[model samples]
Target: MSEADVTVIGAGVVGLAVAAALAARGRKVYILEKNEGIGRETSSRNSQVIHAGLYYPPGSLKARTCVEGNRLLYQLCARYGVPHRRLGKLVAATEAGEEPRLEALASNASASGVAGLRFLTSREVAVLEPRVRARLGLLVPDTGIVDVHRLMELYLWLARERGAELVCRTEAVGLEFTGAGYLVWVRDREGTYAFRSRVVVNSAGLRADRVAAMAGLDVDRLGYRLHYCKGHYFSVCPAKSRLVSRLVYPVPHPQGTGLGIHVTLDLGGRMRLGPDTLYVSEPEYGVGEERRHLFWEGARRFLPDLEPEDLSPEMAGIRPKLQGPGQPPRDFVIRHEADRGLPGFVNLIGIESPGLTASPAIARLVAGMLG
Candidate 1:
């Protein structure tokens, strides 16, 4: 109804973090979310792991932000009383030839300032996880899990407390750049309304490219590819819970799809496996029960004792991948005025895996871009 100094176009984890950062900096921030609640998309459907900056290429934004944000996020969690724990992780090499690749991953992680990565021999891994038959492993003590929904709620609460407004179920349909500022047209149950804002941030996770097109920008011309890769998860039975104590991953594919149907434990101590990358022509979020067989097959690679009946359909998430499966992974595309020549506009595209982990750092970067 009123003009805002800044209008963030999405209320996911990254968007809420950006809004909170801006509000904390004394800006009148307004968050427009298309869903009824924040983080109901990729943010809420993720593995909820606090990555230790592993797997990303050296010197990339994903590597840098994830490494720094890992620390910042833990600090924020502690300060805000958000539920989280440093459960640690292991990049196991069950295959004989995969041992060197695991070592290389450890090297890359160390270069990224991820401390406490110990190279574990077969015997060491045995002591840590007796059931897992890993030839060698890299133990990452900093990786952990968090309550993502609670974190987003905390961000929204802090932002609201600082005079930020959250308009839920409001979808931005069109954008026009006026002489002074941009005009955003939003529609909902109440119909369409026009709002004005000097700065507009496009943090729309899946539809970021569409939002950019709505703003009269070419999606492909931005020199970034927005590929949607769907990942499915299956929950492990409670009886098999004792088989895994920490997160266990296989050597990541150089393509950065985060291969190896690894195991992840949630805050409630529930274990789930999967997130196998599958590229689709269109972005789809629905995970059905028919995929349980595929999940069980993938899970048996590292977890040999897993039974086909032990898995149940859990959830699915899509990553805004910048590169395809076989191609090399690209750095996060955070385009602002410096690159796009669009003043008071910021675009966050292709934010995948570590995006959740690097959310706070991404918010700070967005703030810096605004300034």
Candidate 2:
């Protein structure tokens, strides 16, 4: 890699989406992935849910991108023959105290222009999911799941077809800014190499801040701080997996990331209980069987029939957050930072939940920023 037009710094869904969009515009885009393959990090480790844009606050980047992404993703899947299912989700309230939260959620969804969200009584919940023992529920019909790997492949294929180059096993280690462009220092199996690009987009997911720092940007003052949050998942046994169809979620934790220990189904109809958030200092993805008891308590509220042994260790994924523990939830940080004295250097930080869903929209936003 000697000279390039635009270089994207990550190969996660958002990075791939950005590369594909720029390539489609005939930008001579190059995707720089540190890993041996694409989507191996945050992209592959998620619940793969196509979010309904209901959880995010109105007027935030996450809200706009997710609602728009939800529509665009469905269309992209249909157009590209990507595997997905709009199974819809049941946001359940197990107690009388949690009922108001249901009302608030529906109201909030309406505010975000997310249509087809309606309240579900206990009877309605029983009709939809007989095993769920919730007193009240909110049915978000647009919520769904996707084959994340297929989605990434589709993005990469489209990008490659449009003349984007994906160089795996090459990690961006340093950045040198020229008057017009950037010098990206990267290392691969062979040795260290450098590429010059007129434009550099840092869509590096968890390590986005580090990428920003390499460009001589002050991350702290730039508000590019990132904290790692880990979420563990458990797979339900086959017998119990068949019993659930729609995704079921408990009422959100007030000061938490929302969507507490919830149940998500894959395209194969396998049930997975997960993604309970725990702040960690590093990126660790080992699922602990010891969490089964805690998982049982949280899941058994809605899934009354789930037994202790029904849950098995599955996997874990970490979120790179701009907001730390006990802090107010922050919106997605898509900074052009020309004001920070770095033009053509965009930093996408704290892109967690809905990042997968908002990949396409985020890509469009980044391309627009570059232009």
> How large is the C-alpha RMSD of every model relative to the true structure?
1.5, 0.9
After aligning candidate 2 to the native by TM-score, how far in Å is the CA of 153 from where it should be? 0.4
Q: Residues 244-328, candidate 2, lDDT per residue (tens digit)?
A: 7899999986766757899999998899998898999989888877899999999999999999899999999999988888888
Q: Encode model 1's per-residue lDDT on 1-371: one tens digit a residue.
A: 69999999999999999999999999999999999988989998889999999777778899999998899999999999999999999888878778778888888888888998898888998898888778888899999999999999999998999999999999999888886778999999999989899889999998888888888887777655588899989999999966888998888765556666889999889999988888887867777888888877766767788898898888889988878767776888887843455689888888888998999999999998888
lDDT of 2: 0.90
Q: What is the lDDT of residue 90 in candidate 2?
A: 92
- Candidate-wise lDDT, in order: 0.87, 0.90
TM-score of 1: 0.96
At residue 322, candidate 1 shows an lDDT of 77
Instruction: Per model, state how many residue pairs clash.
Output: 0, 0
Worst 10 residues of 2 by lDDT: 251-260
